[model samples]
Target: MATQTLHRGRLIDHLQLVVNDLESSRRFYAAVFDVLGVPIGGSGEDYFWADELFVSSAASRAAQGALTGRHHLAFQARDRAMVDAFHRAALAHGGRDNGAPGERAYHPGYYAAFVLDPDGNNIEAVHHGDADRSAASVEISF
Candidate 1:
């Protein structure tokens, strides 16, 4: 198993999605994360991960004999163009569009795009417009 790390935040330390097809999920996530500027942290025969997101095959020991149900996960995008690119890349790589890139009533400047992964999970990439942040993320090493 690979070491897992977390970026301290308000809630939810990390998320793992057990999928029926690891390669497909990997491809889909790779393309989408590429647009979001997040790198693939590491991978093993039964799994691959990106930052806080862990994707593994149902056969993996950690999967506990089941696959995850559809869930919604959103990634923060750098800007609207990155959100658009995320949509296009996802569509071209085994993802089905759930929502096109655009602003939403969720809040002001909530530009985002939504897509369903191969397992039907609602994946999103959003940009909350220009704003200040303490840090992009908190990294810890072991």
Candidate 2:
């Protein structure tokens, strides 16, 4: 495949969302991000985590009256500590706990957690790792 040409400007480093219902998404993302411990991107329609990612919400007509499958997203943590932090903060921010932090034997070394946002979107924070005899690996695929 040929490499695409680059544009002269600030490249799309990341994205921010404007949801129909910010409160709902807020709760959902809170729990999810907390487990990941990335931090809220900002306040109001905004969520903040670390310094690189920024998330803010807004009322979207496009998001209303239609159900779409576009809210699924994931974050790669530096280590298990970040994952654990995500889980904790998410719960505090109004997100419900979908799953606790743990290992998955199905994938060579999958460590992950799950949660449902206010909009009923499935969100997750996952870490890829190896299955060694010393660790208690469990099946997490659904």
Best by lDDT: 1
Model 2 regions lying over 4 Å from their true place: 1-18, 23-71, 130-142
Give the range of the ten consecutive residues with the poorest summed lDDT in model 2: 4-13
Q: Which number leads on TM-score?
A: 1
- Residue 71 of candidate 1: its Cα lDDT? 89
The TM-score of predicted model 1 comes to: 0.91
TM-score of each prediction:
0.91, 0.53
For candidate 2, the TM-score is 0.53
- The digit string of per-residue lDDT tens for model 2 on 1-142 reads 6443222222234444445466666665656555554466356433333323334443334334344544556666656766677777766665568888888675766777766655555566777763334422232322
The sequence of per-residue lDDT tens digits that candidate 1 reaches over residues 2-63 is 67665666345678999988899999999988878888988999999887788999888888
